[model samples]
Target: MQTKSFAALAIVALGQFIAGASANSGYAGSCTNIQIYPPDGNTNYWKIAADCKNNAGQTNLNTKINIDSCFSNSNGALVAQLNGSFHSSCTNIILTGTVLSASCRNTGGANVNTSIDTNNVIGNADGALYCFNQGNL
Candidate 1:
């Protein structure tokens, strides 16, 4: 009887352990909120994403950084001409330094505005001139 009780207890403990493990599963999606810097009268492009977790035995700093582009513009006006789309479920994205060549028309800049689920400005959002600043990375 004692042995049977021990076996039953072990099974219950194992079930709880598995459930806890499953509850901690992290999210998955393309990284977002990446900013890059470029020299004057020049263009630069790059792609960045991250997969991080806050626990031991779990992989931390799974960031992938790569140079995705370069451009030729000086007045900083050409810096906001980049065209790309990335989706993610993670929070805490950082865009440090200056951004590179990126530009977006009213409709083209929709990705940036929609990424945060806001209708701030994208040409006709409240009749404001939408500015897509991709250089302030």
Candidate 2:
């Protein structure tokens, strides 16, 4: 009887250990820190965040994103493309600053696409956002 009780307790303990390990098993993402500034003329500030997603369980990511800057007067547009690998399930994104309007969209892909709009699209000297991997709750 004692041996059986000990075996059951051991099994329960092992199950708990396994559950804890799996809780945080598949978490991987790449979040690069970025600082944004207000544009010229406009006093408002703007910032952006990215939450890259991992592709499959293969542990590989091929991402290409564009960041565009459009002047208020329809003065053409400037676009910047990004390329990188994101090896995580999901990433948390946060942005803070003053702007006319800001937003983001997933578009259509494993990677996430974001956008921000300011009245003048001004860049601030000291304004930015933070992005990183989210912890399991």
Candidate 3:
């Protein structure tokens, strides 16, 4: 009976460990100590955090993603309207939990693709609507 009780306690301990690990499911690792002037918002300032980088080997990686279509919904969720001219030069636009990656044809019709940080999207999203309509962002 003592052995069975010990085994149950061990199982409970393991369960608590797993629960603690999963509580930070969206933990971001790419966040660095570097600081910037603007648009440097976290995934709600904590928890998930990372950097947003433009495509590889591009002279002007600052290619602006016209996020004019993004807006806050009534439900306090982010609505990024992607379509039409937004992806006109790109294909293979894939959104992962970490990044919004894509592949696209360059000016010479060659495929040039890169991924930016999805934190920009999430941070740019209705981040102001944090918790009961009160946000520190």
Candidate 4:
């Protein structure tokens, strides 16, 4: 009788402990914001700044930054001329284009990722004019 009660209580306690552990198991990192600006008079040259929450246990930083110049046609999408993964400490970066889009991911532990969609720009230039900045990472 007493033995059976002890066994039941132990099982209940184990179950509660497991549930509590699972509730707290996940990645809790995020990027605050991504800012883009033209470095020179040329709109084709852009600089990017991204702020991230450097949560503990985070190892790698993966980023996909892009620029999309809106044109009259459907082929005016410009990707990041140069983008890749690095240490989480590498926050400041550069992306060149008239429009901007970006994604930042923290990996190697719990996983947290965020992205920014491409922005559209309207002007009196031909669709081909925007192609000057179109390229891949």
lDDT of every predicted structure (CA atoms): 0.29, 0.28, 0.35, 0.31
Candidate 3's TM-score reads 0.30
Misplaced by over 4 Å in model 1 are 29-137
Cα lDDT of model 2 by residue, 1-137, tens digit? 99999999999999985564343222222322222333236422222332324433232222211112221111111112111111111133223432222222232324343333321222211121111212110
TM-score of 4: 0.24
Candidate 2 achieves a global lDDT of 0.28
In candidate 3, what are the lDDT values of residues 11-120, reduced to their tens digit? Answer: 99999865643432221332222121112353211122233232342122111222212222212222333222334454455555545455655556666556654343
Residue range with the least summed lDDT across 10 consecutive positions in model 2 = 128-137
Q: How many pairs collide in each candidate, listed in order?
A: 19, 10, 0, 0
The TM-scores, one per candidate, come to 0.24, 0.23, 0.30, 0.24
Give me the runs in candidate 3 sitting further than 4 Å from their true place.
1-85, 121-137
Clashing pairs in 4: none
Query: In lDDT terms, which candidate is top?
Result: 3
How well does candidate 4 score on lDDT at residue 107?
Answer: 36
Candidate order by lDDT, highest to lowest?
3, 4, 1, 2
Worst 10 residues of 3 by lDDT: 124-133
Deviation of model 4 at 76, angstroms: 2.1
Q: Predict model 1's lDDT versus the native.
A: 0.29
**Per-residue lDDT of candidate 1, residues 1-137 (tens digit):** 99999999999999986564333222221222323322234433333333333334243343432222212122212221223222121112233322222332333333221122111111111111122322112
The lDDT of model 3 is 0.35
Worst 10 residues of 4 by lDDT: 121-130
